[model samples]
Target: MDYLRVAGGRVLRPDGRVERADVAVDRDEGTIRAVGAPDEVDDAVGEPPGEALDADGSLVIPGLVNAHTHVAMTLLRGYADDKPLDPWLREDIWPAEAELTPDDIEAGAELGVLEMIRSGTTAFADMYFAMDRVADVVDRAGLRARLGHGVVTVAKEDADARADVEESLAVARELDGAADGRIRTAFMPHSLTTVGEEYLREGVAGAREAGVPVHLHANETTDEVDPIVDERGERPIAYAESLDALGADDFFAHGVHVDDSEVDRLAEAGTAVVHCPASNMKLASGMAPVQRLREAGVTVALGTDGAASNNDLDVFDEMRDAAMLGKLAADDAAAVPASAVVEMATAGGADALGLPGGRIEAGAAADLAVVDLDAPHLTPVHDPVSHLAYAAHGSDVRHTVCDGEVLMRDREVLTLDAAAVRERAANAASDLVERVESA
Candidate 1:
């Protein structure tokens, strides 16, 4: 509740590099009023009457944006493990989610938001049901997000799916630009394997008309392709192109099986992919051809998928996997360098979501995460960016600020009560386990 002066640190600027500087977060306007050398702005705000956070020359980077996720599934993080995507959804996930009341969803989402804030994820995209409750919890947490009305179809021609589409639109209209521009809605049609072509087209049209981004699951697995192409005589990207939906506003979740032609088309069309590595590996979905896509000049972002799949919304863990997997998948030791990995988690993810964030500049949103440079693994830092993308864990994030509000400071949380939220989520997960077992 005081003026925040973060001094004596290495700040990651807008130019994809780091420099020595300090920042004063103007809580009144929820923006960064001044940034300069340690004392350059000290006199700008007469007397510095608020709390002063000592930076002590640590490294600061913009908070990460998780481009795709289902955070409410935090309750189901490890529920259905070691199963293929189809059986995992058919036998376990959907049934469990069906039993979840709106209250249950709110509790889980609250916990998920708390965890993400502490771990330096300032924003994320979520595709889930009961999004009204999700919005309520997100507003309470004081973070930024892109939420969606979740959809899945069992029939090729179900008019009821149209009603679900309407419901999602209603949610979007009510929640778009909520919480001081921290929350917006994207149209989510589940996936190609789950929804038919007509529904996907309808959803895409609605999103395009509404001037919002469309989030879809594409090429997540080869198993998902048989039904779609066999039924529609085209791959997912081709189907989207035929519908005139492949554009900068469309965000595809996974591209593990997108062919070379599709990558070329995606790069040319300016569509982006949100790679979810942990979920792909855990479900034994083939590794997404991220190296090829990047080489094709496609914009690539990283995500944790969902708690039900990867089981946690930890962006730091995802970055590490992406860095290593990108290198190994290319059979080269330099596919995604440290700087590239950092950009994927920050700026690249922002570009994917169509948000005005992912950089620490005077005119940009005040979204940042500060790490303790004194950590054992991060000592003797030859390159701060390298240390951040490789050595620094989520636990090392000492502070996280989004939209100029300090969500967490000095490894302590402020936006929500972490202890109480964890207790409620634990109770909810226990009930879920009992229900899943008895059923």
Candidate 2:
């Protein structure tokens, strides 16, 4: 059997146990063939694997999933900072975005994809315009994603607003099975308040007909939620439900300001919430009641939101931030434990995005990250899980593998030229800012 082996590492099992194991991957099928002892994997494969990745002195964990992000915003990283969500988007982000070209999107997407590979994120959900270019980057970068065209219709003419909704649906339908099934598509409305109710209803209906899930920002801040509540006489989640936008398959970013009733509705609908702790803090968006949401049987995931607000796309940092912020929000140190945040970064994220590659078991998507535990910050690893949530950094990743393909090995990315991507993104960002300024 043609397979690749990840040899001699402590594997983080689905049940959270760490054990010495070797994982065999069926490269042809892009699935985990076996995950067990060295002899056990050999027995399962029926032959020695032709290729192997050294996992010695490392811990093999499922590749992180950035469930919600505007990846191409990597070009806008640090372009605008120290502002609230509404003003930040209106005053800086939207102006810069209006000046973006498809080429700029591609350059920025390559930069974001390169960062994700280097940092061990194998899958993410991106909601932004010019997503065809982002999808191309994902295909070439050997990553998984749920890509969508973000539609915002608040300030547009009726015809233009309808056209935006149609474009989102068209992009979703056209790109559903692209990249050999590694890329899925979603219908993304920019946010509950940023989109009109009629367009949202139309877009969600079209998405349902096309058999795609919906993603959006919801209840991110008091400014966002108060208007919906005041106008609709109900909460944002209820307003979403009224539009038929809430569903088992749908996921929302930032449920930061959601209350108990909204939490109940989310739990009942099986809708997932992607907590962006760093982004929330950066924008002064209220802390998400992550522990409360989880206690209500809601599936909670972690996201970096976008590099503009998050300043980075590192899921390890998200995990650490989620744990810390959750504890503060709940006023309990045990509110979000290491195990919980780690699971959120992996399984919860995959489940939220309706993608694969959050576990390392047989028949699961072969997405894995090897974290080198030999660093000074990680010395005397009392519990690897603890280290993952509290101490680990993206640079700790030694190897990143997705879909049975090695994207990065030994701290060097193999799929894309790191230097070239950075250079292109820098140039694009400079050009974009200049255009926005000149306009």
Candidate 3:
């Protein structure tokens, strides 16, 4: 019967309504038990059994979910930038990554998790390497995550490629349901272009047998799509479907170069696409057809990709970029409205990950973010939802709660030591650069 209450804030409800309310969480189960006006919730809960967070002058919204990321890439932030994806990976990122150790991965993950928590992200789906370290960081930081080791097989012998595939599957199986259910696992092939047909099919088959969903990069650029279409005689999505990779539980990252038919196929499969607008823009990758995907009944979520590409893991920035780019890409002023972008950052992401906590209501998981609207930039709050999409920044988040536990309060992260994490990651990055250069 442990309880924690968030009192006196404007709560964003499931249906996009905003009301002054108090949210009561059953700490034992980490679920919202009551949400109503302060006096009403007080009467319903008969006093918080443990603690209460004062949320006056704040807007309480569901914690944002980052649907796709490479969390440990925090070590590589600014290591390689202003280059396209292929050369950027081949020349800079891969060589540096080959020098990383498990400690390096943990340090980078800790830094990434610190960034996400401070920025009001409660959960994320990550496709990266050394995911056991990633899961450890997520659990320790009190955030929920779905993690998988990214598998790349191209330019390798069959034995080496098969070994990579096996390792990816092994990591997924070993890590699923770890960390008191705070961690989930997925099968992540780096990309359709990077993974050969036989390897992709085998990985997907093993994932299906293991009951894990698939996550990967697909159609990220015209370069990736043209070659696939030239060789397969169809779209990238068609090739993915041919290998039985399309499913309701599966989600893809960066479907930027997808065509209308590909969007239709994704919608038909009930699959989700995570839009990483900042990363795509920074890499000079083409804009994703977010409006078309949503119009086709596909669920679209927002992401920051990874710090190395986006240069920062900020979902608020992602929302703003998504709105601006969607309109320009579609050449319509109303292509992606503010509300749509807000939904993509919150509920859309949670839904895509098959987790709860996107909505503020009874029986929902108690994952929430508190934004200090008292700032001058947030003045004259014409519309809270509009503010979330068009005006807010990560620094405006004053508090973060996940699983009914207060992780950050008043701009201070409680579960993670931010200063220590930043120092460790800085040292790791410095050493990694030296090692790669020396080699």
Q: Looking at candidate 3, what is the lDDT of residue 371?
A: 90
Candidate 3 wrong stretches, greater than 4 Å: none
lDDT, ranked from best to worst: 2, 3, 1
lDDT of 3 by residue, 1-439 (tens): 8898888899998888889998999988989999998788878888655888888989999999999999889999988889999999999998998999999999999999999999999999998888888888888899898889899998999999999999999998999988778788899999999999999999999999999999999999998999998988999999989989999989999999998999999999999999999999999999999999999999999989989999999999999999999999999989999989888988999988887778889999999999989989999998998899889999999999999989999899999888999999999999999999999
Provide the lDDT at 50 for model 2: 84
Q: Residue 21 deviation, candidate 1, in Å?
A: 1.0
**Which 10-residue span in candidate 2 carries the lowest summed lDDT?**
223-232
Colliding residue pairs in candidate 1: 3-50, 256-288
Off by over 4 Å in 1: 1-3, 43-49, 155-157
Distance from true location, Cα of 306 in model 3, Å: 1.1
Q: Against the true structure, what is every candidate's RMSD? A: 1.9, 0.7, 0.9
lDDT tens digits, residues 92-126, model 2?
99999999999999999999999999889999999
The best candidate in terms of TM-score? 2
Candidate 2: Cα lDDT at 284? 91
Residue 335 in model 3: lDDT: 98
- lDDT, candidate 2, at 93: 97
